[model samples]
Target chain A: MNTELVLFGVFAVMTLVSAGLVITARSPINSAMALVSTFFFLAGIYVLLWAHTVAVMQVLVYAGAIMVLFLFVIMLLNLGEAAHRGRPTVTRILGGASAFGLLAVLAVTLGRTQALPAQMSAEVQGKFGTMAAIGESIFTTWLLPFEAVSLLLLVAMVGAVVVAKSRI
Target chain B: MVPITYYLLLAAALFCMGMFGVLVRTNALVVFMCVELMLNAVNLTFLAFARMHGALGGGPNAVFGVGHVSAFFVIAVAAAEAAIGLAIVIAVFRSRGSVNVDDIRTMKH
Candidate 1:
């Protein structure tokens, strides 16, 4: 019934609805656009949770840069609505059942669990969640993982070029 | 204080919606979007824990380590994930000439 809950509820709904649209929308472009909205809603939720840094990165990275790349590819390819209609594949059925099972497990776990007692009431606010703090941490304590991620990106980049580029 | 349960529940719902999208959507691009949704859901979980633990100091110092630095680590990873994932999806679409999962039936019976 408070501001946090109100914000969470709004963003939650936005996330769900846009995510649904991401699947059901006919055009790939439409789905990608819906995904942008979904990212925006997610960023809002992150803001509500006091994750100012993650929220900014969510919009800038996912909704802004990544999405622009997606749009470019979509336009370059000029992919139309897929010609063939789908019939259920075994992968889908199995995947759906597994998802259902996971959902049930999570529901039971959360429904029965008690809330952890609040250890401390940190009333911290914004700007502190800026890029600088994130950068410092990434370079210091998380340097190894950070470097690993860079390596992963490098591999992925090479792989993508290999996969997409026309044979010489 | 917004109970952590509420955030967890929201995360669960988002994850489920994303899972459903991955399963039901024929378009590879939509599937990719769904994956992003799932990642965002996980981010919510991380932020919730970060707040509960005082690890990120709730705002400016909102981080993930002993000294409130791990939070940025997660965000950096997420960025890397998005970049790599979209690149792969784009590459796959280019080669296949379609973004429909159903179109890639080579793995099927």
Candidate 2:
């Protein structure tokens, strides 16, 4: 077995398990911590996929910045232990059934797609995940979206401040 | 190399778990965390597709594929979403004194 496959397996398991904890943990702080681990594992998966830039951003943005925001909110709220609600209710049952249905559909669709070749060719692999290559595309053809994202960030920042301010 | 389907399946499972959390959890903050989980699942799909495209000779120089660019936008949007969403959560907690979704029914009153 190759090292790549082993790493993929390990990362995949870590990501999914941590994500499961993020949702199921009764304490929001615990859930936030789990989400942090989830982000880190996801960054590992991104590395395996050869999107090194995206992987770094995943760790920097999701694990570092976004999670800090989440923890801040959780602390600011001072949430107590969520009340121990009973097992699955009707809404939950329906929600789970539908989600599983969606999973089935996605599985079928994914199964149909051809698998990647056993080995990636050299030219295709080279420089694909580098920051330079990503920068080239982002500044060249994808410039408009790049600009738009900045605008979006500005609006989100202003809106967040306005909403979080105590006084209207 | 691992099959692309494995990544897709993993993403699907993560997405479903997130959905289950959103539906079942009463704590608004936990629900928000689930939403982030779902977004990460989507990011996995994007990276998987990007890898596939790159493997298919659609190199990083190819202008047609949107693998990395789409993932970039997704990450940016998710950041914005986390900021605004938490701000709203904080605002709600400030006004309601609690962040439980079931108890914060303003419209019914």
Candidate 3:
């Protein structure tokens, strides 16, 4: 088998297993930890797809920074008691059913779509998924979206601070 | 010995599973993790498309290049998103004394 297929298999198994643990694990903290591994495996899959930059960012941002913050909250909240109760409500059941419906739709779509396009050309491969190219696009073609995202993030930051500081 | 399709399908399955986790689990932290899984799913789609579009040189690179560049930008944005999202989650958890979605629904009225 080709290297791409082999690497993809490894990452795929890793992702699925970690994702399973994210749900099945009893401890909320353990679930968070399992998610970190899921992110790592996902990064591997990205690498196999030749998206080197995304893979690096996946490991650095999601697994590293995000998971750390999640752990911080879990620890600070000390949610052992609340987590044990496991919120069992009608809304949760409805939400779960909707999520399952979405899965069914996606499966049907995938099954119906055949004859996907093949891999990319040679010169593009030579470009080396560099930061420079990405920067250029972000500043040029995707400039508006980039700026909008920045503004959104700033607003989110301010909102977080305000919410956290509100009189309880 | 698996094919790339297998990987893609697996990613899709994991993504859906995570989505289910987000919807079913009332904990804000678990939902956040599920969102991360969704982002990872998009990352897989990006890479697959990048590979499928063929190399990044010649006319294609000069004209419509969606392979690696889009993927990289997406990852950066995902980072920023996670930072902001986690901060918000923290804020909400602090105010409500609980991260359970159902229990924290004061704004619904």
Q: Largest TM-score belongs to which candidate?
A: 2
Cα lDDT listed for each candidate: 0.71, 0.84, 0.69
The CAPRI category of model 2 is medium
Q: A131 in model 2: Cα distance from truth in Å?
A: 0.5
Clashing pairs in 2: none
Model 3 chain B weakest 10-residue run by lDDT = B56-65
Ranking by DockQ: 2, 3, 1
Higher-ranked by DockQ: 1 or 3: 3
Overall local distance difference test of candidate 1: 0.71
Highest-scoring model, DockQ: 2
Once fitted onto the true fold, the runs of candidate 3 whose alpha carbons sit more than 4 angstroms away are A81-90, A115-119, A166-168, B1-4, B55-85
**Best-first order by lDDT:** 2, 1, 3
The candidate that achieves the highest lDDT relative to the unseen native structure? 2
B16-102: candidate 3 lDDT, tens digit per residue: 887788777767777777877777777677666656554435353352445565665566566566666666777777666677777
Where in model 1 is the C-alpha error above 4 Å?
A116-133, B56-96, B107-109
lDDT of 2 by residue, B4-93 (tens): 888888889899889988988888888889998898889888888877766354444555336888898999999999899889988888
